[model samples]
Target: MARKKASPEDKIIDAALKLALAQGWRDLALADIAAEAKIGLPELAHIFHSKADILAAFERRIDAEVLAAAETEGIESESPRDRLFDVLMLRFDALGPRKPALKRIALDLAGDPMGALSLIRPALQSLGWMLEAAGIDSSGLRGAIRVRGLALVWAAAFRVWLNDGEDQARTMAELDKRLRQAEEWKDALSRLRTRKTDDAAA
Candidate 1:
């Protein structure tokens, strides 16, 4: 199959990530990204209002890639936990190449609490898609709990992944352990809810 051409937004995202790798995310201006992308500042502004917007766009792109690949891979026959594991691993695979740039960005963002706060919504949005791709429900109350649980899991594993070697062995181990812990917590919560329901009925 012929490769699809990169869109203007994609070009801008690619340029921004590349610049982040070279100069660190904290130092790059919109104009720098525009120059790197070979697009004028006016054009860049039309596509993205700020660096956070570009980061969100990059995350959305990762979500799309993982969702598409998961659809192709299919995991309907697997257990729910297994399905989620596969989906998340696929996400890590998509993120693998950008690890260095992401590390730099993450380090820079560590000191910027407000900037980190801005990412929460987009991160949750991506995680919701990941849950959906795993054939899991990501709506309403239970869905909200699941999203938060997955967020913690992702956060813990992401820290390990940032420093993990190219083999990703440690990242996979950390992710698996965290997922199991989350599963236990989820099961306990479900049982607690069941007990409350029974008590109310009685």
Candidate 2:
């Protein structure tokens, strides 16, 4: 069936997110949201009917925006070494408080990794693009090696972002450090491949 028009439920979601950003996720109520949204309780209930429904809508709303923003950014000043960081920059911007919907989605990721993986695909695809753009053609290399190398870099970046306890300054430093290490590994492998090619010719 064709989707119904936007309703007061959406307004309540927007209001809740605005309040959550203004305050924090820990405090928000249906009545407060209704007031903020300027919608009557019954009208909001007719669409959402419960707090959970509103929150779900809010998260979905956030996730879509974050993805769209990343899509718009595409990539920037990118190298194979720093592509993931650019992706992170775009995502973090989208994750700001005013975008409470995305905040909810992020909070949910800790408990729901399958969902998180779905959310993570854009970053992965961005990394893949970086690899291709940098002329690292997997088809020209050993398939297993290419896959494993990319997987390692991606996994390390994801883990650091998820669990690093350092302050933001140190964290960005670490991100840069990790990118350098990934580039170093790629360089080393290329040198080894060149040596092997010379050996084969000899």
Candidate 3:
């Protein structure tokens, strides 16, 4: 089957990523992105308000790609951990082509704490979708914990991925290790909650 045509939003995202790879993200202006995308500034503004919005749109695009791939593969019988592992690796695969651009953005954003802080909410929201894709419940207090835990896991793995070779062995190892640690932490938290409930009853 033929691939679907890229939408205007996708075109702008592609242009921004391409520009980020060539010139770095921080110094590139919105006008640069518009010219790169072959669209006028008014059209670009209609789809995206700012560069941050473009980045967020790119993140959402990756999320959708991962989810679509997960749906096609059908890992329903796998354990939650295994499913989550697969889902996250799929996400990495989608991101692999743009690693250089992402690395530049990561380094530039590191100095901008508020910029980094602004992304946390969208990151958590994406992680929540990841949890659901893995057939895990991403709701309520336990879901909140899982989202936060996954955030740490993603951060640790992302740091490794930026420096990882094409084989991605180190990145995969880090992701696996972090997921195991998160599982242990989740179990410990569950036990603590149980203990507190028992004490309350007593």
Candidate 4:
């Protein structure tokens, strides 16, 4: 069977991820990534602006794959929480190949709040899409809160996931527990909102 060649952008992103994982994101350089990808400096520059951009591109690719998986898997029949679980599991599967890189990136950014800050926007975007993929609402003020909250939940699960061994049993357990807790909280908030609405009506 013939091997499918990666696109220019994929080649660049793959090279950058490998370099960042091998070293650290802070030490990654465009020239090195260009060399690793076997592309000229000018060509690499034409594709991405910086290491952060490359990381974001990689994340977007993962997000797209997760969304596609959600559709193909026909998760609409499941409950919202179950749908999200399935979608996220698909995301983890998509990221399976780069788990080591992700773990390294997390460790490198742990003490650097400012460095990790760049990911907040991208994380929010990813969560918003994840919510939508799970057939949940992801718009307006409520959507904003859901996105932020889910991002935190996912982040917590992701930390556990990084250390989880090949079975991923621990990661799945943590994610399920967290999602159940979130659902309980969501229910409580809904009840509170209903009471407030009744009070206002009275």
Q: Give the winner by lDDT.
A: 1
- How well does candidate 1 match the true structure in TM-score terms? 0.95
Residues 77-167 of candidate 2 have per-residue lDDT tens digits of 5464565565544443444444345445445455765644553444434444444433445454463455456656555554455444434
Candidate 1 residue-wise lDDT, 1-202, digit = tens: 9999989899999999999999998878999999999999999999999999999999999999999999888866478888888899899999999999999999999988898899999999999999999999999998998999899999999999999998889988998899899889878988999999999999
TM-score for every candidate vs. truth?
0.95, 0.43, 0.94, 0.93
Off by over 4 Å in 4: none
Comparing 1 and 2 by lDDT, which wins? 1
Candidate 3 lDDT, 1-202, residue by residue in tens: 9999989999999999999889887788999999999999999999999888898898899999999999998766567888888889889999999999999999878987887787888889999999999999999998998899899999999999999999889988999999998889878988999999999999
1 or 2, which is superior by TM-score? 1
Instruction: Give the winner by lDDT: 1 or 3.
Output: 1
Q: What is the lDDT for 18 in model 3?
A: 91
Residue pairs with backbone atoms closer than 3 Å in model 3 (clashes): none
**TM-score (C-alpha) between model 4 and the true structure:** 0.93
Positional deviation of residue 129's Cα in model 3 after best superposition, in angstroms: 1.0
What's model 3's lDDT at 49? Answer: 90
Candidate 3, RMSD to the unseen true structure: 1.5
| Deviation (Å) of 131 in candidate 4 | 1.1
